[model samples]
Target: MEKEQKKNKKPAFVAVKGIYEIMPAEFPWWDRFLEVAEGVSKFYNFERIETGIVENADLFLRSAGGEGTDVHKEMFFIKSNKDKWVLRPEATASVARAYIEYGFSRLQQPVKLFYFGPMFRHENPQAGRYREFRQFGVEIIGGENDPVFDAQAISLASRILKEIGFKDVVVEVNSIGCRVCQPAIKKKIQKYYRTNIKKVCRDCQTRIDVNPFRVFDCKREECQEVKKAAPVFLDLVCSNCQKHLKDVLEYLEELSISYELNNNLVRGLDYYDRTVFEIFVEAGSKGEKKEENASKLAVGGGGRYDYLIEMIGGRPTAGVGFSFGVERIIEIMKKKEIKIPAQKNKYKSVFFVHVGEVAKKRSLKLVEELRKNGVGVIEGLSKDSFAKQLKMADKGGAEVAVILGQREVFEESVIIKNLKTGIQETVPVEKMAEEVKRHIK
Candidate 1:
């Protein structure tokens, strides 16, 4: 006890700030989620990529748009005495940075990559949100501005939902259009908001001049009225935007991808172009045992970024990606009562038992020898009573308990007792490894 006390004990993580950890209890659910994400990705030809968390704040400010979307408005920026940096607000923008820096275009067209990591945003913490939250997402870069690819990314987002036992995936899709149609839409939207500025929320009024489309995205009651009457770009999409959107829908129909047309949908990013989409919830509605809150609960979203690569100083390569919030997925899983697999027993080998100090000391050497030979052994060397030692062995979930005493240690043999069958036999210590392997099989 004194020797154990002399060693420095690991510090307890007591009162960990925000949302993050690596502990034994968390492994089952995390492993399950990873297994599902990896399986779905492998089934769909997506490889993995990990990007560093710290980035230049301008990367998000320029690419996510000057518009005060969640990323720009709530990013966690760090200004040191020497330099300025920011934690990543989302994965796709960083993926775009990786695409531009690493020359992925030289290797393959449509470089499909998967990512799982944490993103930081300074939103008020809620049921599905935290300052530090994780995201699991995939991106396909170095492709042409194809509507089929837009539909494909949305389909992959839905595939993850289904793989994670989500009952229904309601995809809300729209086309935010290209440079030509988008400017006109912004003009008309600003004009309309200009007249009814008093009726709009304070944020909407500010966004009227800077980011009027985001005014439609507001959920406040006053903004809802503005959104209800706002000019929709879907109605004013040009010939090229019209055909691309139509082609995207046609591909969805061809691939049997189910979705709803939400003309009001403007994703919270600046660089998005043409088709955009969000995956929502419609759970427990198949039969009468349905949920009262079976409405549109958004879990994942993404869209086309025809100008993102260029926005970050690269060639005019189109990129599309989808991101699912890990915490939100966990919240929904809890609400839907998803079952995580239990951890299996780790005590599958022999438990060493001894009577006195000499047997106990010698028992340590034999225990180490067995372990060195790839055997799992549990021992209570300080324990002198047979009853107490066997009790510890029982609690370990060991299949068999090896009994060693001063007599057995002197003979250089051990007694193996099958806990399940209560049978005993004497086996030489040198042959114990082979005997235990047989029992294990």
Candidate 2:
């Protein structure tokens, strides 16, 4: 009876509500995405950089701004003895912190960096949004505040999405100007909202007083209606901001990347300034007429944050970067039924199947030898049955299966089976690695 109770006891723990595990089956898709991202990063000559996952809470509050931003509210705080730390809500602020601590400014102008990691956000879980999700981002920091960098960042992001099989990509870009012109634009928006305050939501009412630019970011039905007639930032931007935006647009045109001028698209973050852009993918083919009212979900976005470094205690530096939600990208791929082929190293395409304890021991030594010889090999040594082991090899898509049995082990030889041709041959132990390569060819 006691034994029965022990067997029936329920699990004492479960995964946290919004957190998830990436199982082995889903690794191929992730590996393929990272391969493409790395390839793009290499082509652009961006160095990979990683920052700590936990940081001072003030880092985000200062860089992302006060209560008006989502990042500030969604941050997960922790108490470490006397010091307060927060799981990094985003990478931009952390990267900026690194730039300051490492004195990256002393190295080179416009130091290019890329990162891939998980970010924590305490938000409502949805299709693509999660409490914890992976992000792939790039940052170009220091140097002159060139509009060309803006266009280059967008181009790199677009190229990554295209390479990952996203079709009908669209970039919506806008400029909110720098501190010089943004104040005037904010006043115009503030005045407009003050007049239509009754028609707007409670959130927009507060947004008008704190961050008027965020008024346009509201999605409330009533607020959207009121925002339709709200003042536009493009018309109020100073001449420098105007020319900067114009140059960015022209550079994008030269790259042949299509874009829509969305004057109302103010990104939800506080650090953004001057040019901001978001990348979206149409649900279907380009031939299908897209509805003007049809909403395109944004998979990735970023913009210039010229003041963020200074805000995070670094010297004033021009910075531009973009981050893509890895989960969202994978979700879109699955919805489109896009199949990612398993990434098999050509040299490691051989699978080893062994039967009985003697063969299993011999197979382990043989596999290590093959690896030492620069041959990639896979094996199911833990699996005892020969049939089950062969099935696993087939499932792994191995080009050839190296089979060994007690009899073959005793004879100091192995069997090389061509999985595709259904042909088998016996090769001596000393020549097995060479024979496997020949079979692969």
Candidate 3:
């Protein structure tokens, strides 16, 4: 009875909630997107860099701007020995930490780098939003605080989305100024909110005194109405901040990239200063209703974070970067029915087939030889029947199948059959790899 009970028990094992697996069928779309991103990075002269998935908790606490930020609250913390480490909720802080630890300052100024990896955040999952997701980002560090870099970063992001088939994309830009001008704007914002405190949400009321800039980012209906009447940062900025933004706009115009100036477009992150922008795509034809709905679908965003490196123990360095959620981009591609061609080689694929024991042994040697010669090869050597093996080769998308049977083994030769043209020829064992190549062409 006890044994029967044990046998009837159901095992409890399943994938964690909010995390997903990328199956083989969907890899083509991912590959195409990454290819375009890599090409864009190369064209812009940005080198690739990678940092650890786990980092010191204090690194984010200090560099990402204190305890009030969303990035801080969403961090997944783990204790290691006496220290606390967190799964990186974002890469900017990790990259900044790497810059300081590796002494990148001694090298050339404006070290451009890009990264493609996964980031973790403990948040409720939704469509295109996962607790663990992949990100592709680029950063320019150690440069002079030039507005040109800001425009360049935005231009690169816009170009990438365009190349990936997002036709109706727009960049919304704003400037919150630096330490020199932000205090005046903050004071004005505080005074404005204090008068209408009861009208705003509880969260916004709490955040008003702590971080007034974030009040512009509130999405609630009640708070948004209050925000519309608040003081705009553009009018309150100092002369330098004004000129910096104007120059960025001029450069963007020269590049032929479309942009919209928004006074209330403050990013949620605390490190952002001077210039901030978000990339949004239109769902359909441009109209009042469609435009209003499209603005909510922000595909990607980033801005200048000049003070971030200094906060993490590095010298005062200027930096700018942007990151896009890979899953979100893929979701858009599917919704738009964008087709991606199968990523096959320029050379035709050669499938290997064998009949009988001796040919099976020899087929292994031929596959290795073909692979070593840089030939794309596929095979079904386990099947004993020749007809079934050939069927698999056709289904596997092979252009040609190389068959080795008892007769061919005795003659010390092999038969190469072109699946497309139904042509067959026998070649010497020593010349099989070369002959296969010739037939594939």
Report lDDT (Cα) of residue 124, candidate 2: 82
What digit string (tens of lDDT, one per residue) describes model 2 on residues 32-150?
88999988987999999999998988899988886547877798888555676889988988888898898898987899999999999988887667888999999999899999999
Q: Give model 2's TM-score versus the native structure.
A: 0.92
Q: All candidates' TM-scores? A: 0.84, 0.92, 0.93
TM-score winner between 1 and 2, please give it. Answer: 2
lDDT, each prediction: 0.81, 0.86, 0.85
lDDT of 3 at 396: 79
For candidate 2, give the lDDT of residue 86.
Answer: 88
Off by over 4 Å in 1: 1-17, 67-70, 282-289, 292-296, 341-408, 414-417
Candidate 3 accuracy as TM-score: 0.93
By TM-score, the candidates rank as 3, 2, 1
Reference-based lDDT, residue 228, model 3: 90
Give the residue spans of candidate 2 off by over 4 A: 1-11, 67-69, 285-295, 341-344
Which pairs in model 2 have colliding backbones? 348-376
Off by over 4 Å in 3: 1-11, 283-296, 344-347
Worst ten-residue run, lDDT, model 2? Answer: 1-10
Candidate 2, residue 1: lDDT: 12
